[model samples]
Target: MPRWEPDARTRLEKAALELFAERGYDGTTVADIAERAGLMKRSFFRYFPDKREALFGGTPLLVGHLEQYVTEAPPGIRPWPLLVDALTGTARFFPEDRETARTRHRVVTANPELREREVLKTATLDDLLRDLLTARGTPPRQAAYLVRLALTMYEQAFTHWLTPADPEPDFTECVATAVGDLERVLGEWGDGG
Candidate 1:
């Protein structure tokens, strides 16, 4: 058999996910993941702080991309469109491997600990989004509302993108659709619907 030859981080992440799937997240340890990956325990720490991070470690990079997009958006763009632009810019990180994405989603969803961590990560991203918007001179109250709306839209788009039934839209299209839905809902609500 050809040897599995992913890089150290990829190898560790793969091993962690496999172990998490086979033995449950709490049942798997960092050492176990490192051993499975054919590396030492310390090597695992070099890539991820702990097992949970192996799954969610990409958040900071994504948040950074969103912040950059917001920071560089053209002056006077409306809050909703700016938020959409930032979200769409971060779509680069969404995996094209649908099955792998689905598996990770299942693994995260199935574990309470992982779900809690996911919530924390989402909250962190929300804070970052609000801060970025405020730095761009968006009013604080508007930024707060926009932060929640943007995160809700992102979650909807991500969940839709991960489902295997339909031919999935491009990540940006998913974001656009979510934003459009939010706009329509807001319009209807404003009209007393």
Candidate 2:
């Protein structure tokens, strides 16, 4: 075994996803993932504290991205546009390759534990977003409502972006489409439909 290997983190992530998909999340062990990545168990710990974290290693970075975007947004920007900008800015954190994303989504959704983890991670994000907005002078109630809308927009955009027939839809464009759909819905209510 080499004393040092570059990109060990990426290698381990790919290995873990492959194993999780193949052997199922519970069936796959930390040792199995490390070995598949051509690393040792110790190396796995160096990257992720546990097996479940391998699928969520990017959570902190994602949280930080939102934090930075919200904090640095232009002074005159309203909460809704800020929310949209913050959410769309996260496009870089996700995989450009749709299949890799689909596989990870599959692995997470297929397991109850993983699904719970996903929910917890999402809640953490939503809470932070609301807090960030409130900190930036948005009313607490409005911040909370914006967070909920952002969550819906993100989910809708991601699902549409992951569609198999799209053949390379841009995540940002998908988000714009969701925003448009939301506007259309709100417009209907305004017209007393």
Candidate 3:
């Protein structure tokens, strides 16, 4: 066995997922996760604050990747496409391990706490994204709205892509479909009137 319980974070996350699926969120304990990981209880704390965190611990990894993607965009590129590319980066992150992704979706959807944590993470991420857009010359109010819209599209695209019955799964295409759907929904009031 490796000293210091290497990759303690990933190990804890995996162990927590298995326990949560088996015992349900409220029923699982930190010590239980640490034990399953063959780690000391203190090591679990070094990784996550509590069992609830493991439910959506991958969130920070996603946010950091998004920030990196946004920061790398050519200076003049606007926020929407930047947002799309960031969401697309997950195409690599996901489908990397389909079984893991499927199990994650199932766990997140099944538990109310997990779902709420996911939503909170989204809201926090939107705030950070909007800040970056504003830094890139977007006006504050518009930056906020645009980030919110892009994130909504990204979210719907993810759901569509991950739905087990999806006939043609593709988040990028789903994003375009979501944007088109939004346009149609809002275009009803127009005639350019």
For model 1, the local distance difference test gives 0.84
Q: Candidate 3's residue-wise lDDT over 28-47, tens digit each?
A: 88899999999988888887
Candidate 3 — what's its lDDT?
Answer: 0.80
Better of 1 and 2 by lDDT: 2
Q: TM-score-based ranking, best first?
A: 2, 1, 3
Assess each prediction's global lDDT (C-alpha) against the native: 0.84, 0.91, 0.80
By lDDT rank, best first, the candidates go 2, 1, 3
- Stretch of 10 with least lDDT, candidate 1: 1-10
Comparing candidate 2 with candidate 3, which one achieves the higher lDDT? 2
lDDT of 2 by residue, 1-193 (tens): 8867899999999999999999999999999999999998899998898999999999999899999999988778999988888888888988867789999999999999999999999899999999998998999998998899889999899898878873667988899999999999989987998
Q: For model 3, how big is the CA root-mean-square deviation? A: 2.5
* Per-residue error (Å), model 3, residue 76: 2.0
- The window of 10 residues in a row where model 3 has the poorest summed lDDT is 90-99
State TM-scores per candidate: 0.91, 0.95, 0.85
